[model samples]
Target chain A: MADLIEISDPADPRLADYRDLRDVELRKSLESSEGLFLAEGEKVVRRAVAGGFEPRSFLMAPKWLDGLADTLATTDAPCYVMSEKAAEEVTGFHVHRGALASLKRRPLPSVESVLAGARSVLVLEDIVDHTNVGAIFRSGAALGFDAVLLAPRCADPLYRRSIKVAMGAVFALPWTRLPDWYEALPSLSAAGFTTVALTLADDAVDIERAVEGVDKVALVLGSEGHGISPRWQHASDRRAIIPMSAGIDSLNVAAATAVACYVTARR
Target chain B: MADLIEISDPADPRLADYRDLRDVELRKSLESSEGLFLAEGEKVVRRAVAGGFEPRSFLMAPKWLDGLADTLATTDAPCYVMSEKAAEEVTGFHVHRGALASLKRRPLPSVESVLAGARSVLVLEDIVDHTNVGAIFRSGAALGFDAVLLAPRCADPLYRRSIKVAMGAVFALPWTRLPDWYEALPSLSAAGFTTVALTLADDAVDIERAVEGVDKVALVLGSEGHGISPRWQHASDRRAIIPMSAGIDSLNVAAATAVACYVTARR
Candidate 1:
């Protein structure tokens, strides 16, 4: 069983990690410096633990403790029991999901290690939206993509919103940031993966044609605003478009990834 | 040239349709009652007009007026030019997008009309999230899905956020609310559609296999929470899932729609 601590004050030093969550800059700094990121809701908390992430601590109301009993039994980390009011005062939002846990972030696997033994992969270049990043990870993992490789500027998948939107897929997927933005596709090519970028280049073939019968594929998707950089676009072995109906410019990046991954998975 | 009105006061009654945008319930009430919805940002505003949505009025800063001159020349609607501060005061948020427009919403076409001459379609069931609805519309439009039929409770496609997320594809695509909740799939089947519910039933076929050679297909999708209603599930001609990897329950509804649309479109 986990040790239970009662905390009456929202500003208590023990509750420092949970404070000012709406302040993204402060939370980002605090989380990185302390090597901790939060997993909200009971399901996400359990998934974090089950996915092999070490919990630094947990915060919840008394009612929440029951649902997480199995999760608590497996860890020595103390579960901080506080009122819902206290949670809002600390977190700057409603604690509607009833539980939150701070977990130690593990070192990301290297690109080669994540891609090892993988037949299909997703390469996200500066997908800045946390929700989009999380949604892509969920689709990638669900469709059984082997791994995900992110550009250096891609939003952190372990960020609270990403973790929640990904429905814990971020915990299961093996992913790492590419060391060199320019050489990202070239390196994947060297490793025997065909880099098919989802773009609207004139030379682009339909997505179905691009992924057809490819043995190993890295589906490169760019950020929502500007698409893949010109260099990455040129480095790709093939350019593919989803063949949109006239008047619609493009799918949201996450939606594009889903379609691309689905086609490549079948291929 | 379009008529330009200088509105210095944020409380101008003419701008009531654009007020309290962040308040969902209030906006829904006003938009529906007035038969109007907002289109935000330059790109979305342009697409809305280009996509055939009639503008009731336009709001923009003086600098924004230059780029939209051609568009304004085509419409007789009054364009309200306001200072940035006045725009914020009226809308209850930063008007960083520079402009907003109140577009008259056309009467929703009947399901039969939306399905006219269309072989591939998407059916959304109670997808409550506006963003997901928009993303699905975008994917449907981009992937060449001919139409969309939403369950009666689905979020409004013309809702501002949905239009923004859809990049105005909602204006281009023909969609209507299914008149009957329980009979939604059965009605589609009666209309010569192969109603394929995207579900996790044990007997569900792979989406690619499910759509192969089907002349007319209606890919049915449910909401984030409770999926397809039991009635609709039972009513669909077949249940099809995207065949996710084990331990991953499902993709986000929008992502699921994207994959399903892509596969069905290729068929």
Candidate 2:
């Protein structure tokens, strides 16, 4: 069983992992360098442990301890209980769900391992918003997409915000960053997957037509500000558009990903 | 032509409309009581003006004036020019897009007028998040949904965050609050729309099959946390689900809206 320790001071060194949660730049570097990721809320905390991640520690208000008693029984990780105010001071934000876990991030598996026996996948290029990255993962997982591939510049799916927005879907999905960005689409095609890029290119066909009768499908999405880059767009096997109404700009990247994944799932 | 006024003081009363943009409660009451709404960035400002919203005033750094010169030339509203830092001090956040406008809020049209001759529509119930509301509008408009109807408790689409995330689609879309939330679905059905609620009920049909052969589709979605209320779910003509993976939870309300809109558009 986990040891429950009552801590009054927010500046305790044992609580270092939870500090500066709102500072994106600082948290990104700290998380990566420390080789750890945070899962916030009771559901995500339980999911993190259930996904086989070893917890370094947990922090929460005293009230949360009872609700998480069953989960706490499964691990020997130290649980630091504090007042909600103190927890907010340590984390730089209110702990809305009242529980958090700092878990070790294992080295990412190889791209081939993630794609093993997978038919439908999402290939995201430069989707740098953590929330968008999280949302896309949730959509892909929920709609039965088998795996995901992210470009080098894509935001980390394990970020606290991403994990929270994803509702722990990030932990459930198989994904890793592409080792080679330049030939990512070509490599997928070589592996016998037909890459359908979601873009507004002149030759783009309707989304349904692009994925029809494909044995293996890889749906490609780009960043928020721009659609797909010219290099990737041209290199993709099929370019698809969602056939939007005239005079409207494109859907939000996450929304587009959901639509694309839904269509590809049925295909 | 617009009159350009240079102001270095952040406390100027003329800038009241643009104050405390980050505080949701403060901004809501202030904006509603003042009978105005804010449009941030040069593009949204241009879109708001183009959408026929009268401008109460414009606030921006001097550098943005050149890019928005053509738009400013079309409005007689006073323009306040301040340094980026001073603008940040007034607005409580960095104005990344470098321009803002306070526009007059015209009374929302009746639900009947918004739905007049509309073949496809979206009905949102208690979707309180500005970002989600904005995203739903973006997806609905892009996918050719004719209008949007919101329950009385829904967040304001005219909020600045909503406008920014929607990419000014809120200005283009015809939307208004429903006077009667309890009978909304029945009322839509009476108006010849086939009310399709996106819920996870046990008997929910696949979204595609539910919308198949339907004319005048009114796609219904609920709030972020909960699915559709029991009343709305049972009252709708048909219940539909997106057919997600077995182990996964439901999609984010906005992502679900996007996918639902995509299917409904084709139907």
Question: Of the candidates shown, which would achieve the greatest lDDT relative to the real structure?
Answer: 2
lDDT of each: 0.90, 0.93
Q: Could you tell me how far off, in angstroms, the CA of residue B35 lies in candidate 2 after the best superposition?
A: 1.0
Give per-residue lDDT, candidate 2, residue A1. 92
What would the per-residue lDDT of candidate 2 be over residues B13-76, giving only the tens digit for each residue? Answer: 9999999999999999999999999999889999999999999999999999999999899989
Which runs of model 2 end up more than 4 angstroms from their true locations? none
User: Each candidate's DockQ score against the native complex?
Assistant: 0.81, 0.94
Index of the highest-DockQ prediction: 2
TM-score of chain B of 2: 0.99
For every candidate, the chain B TM-score is 0.97, 0.99
DockQ-based class of model 1? high
Q: How close is candidate 2 to the true structure, as a TM-score?
A: 0.98
Q: For each prediction, how big is the interface RMSD? A: 1.0, 0.4
**Which digits, one per residue and each the tens of the lDDT, describe model 2 over residues A139-239?**
99999999999999989999999999999998999999899999999999999999999999999999999999898999999988887899899999999
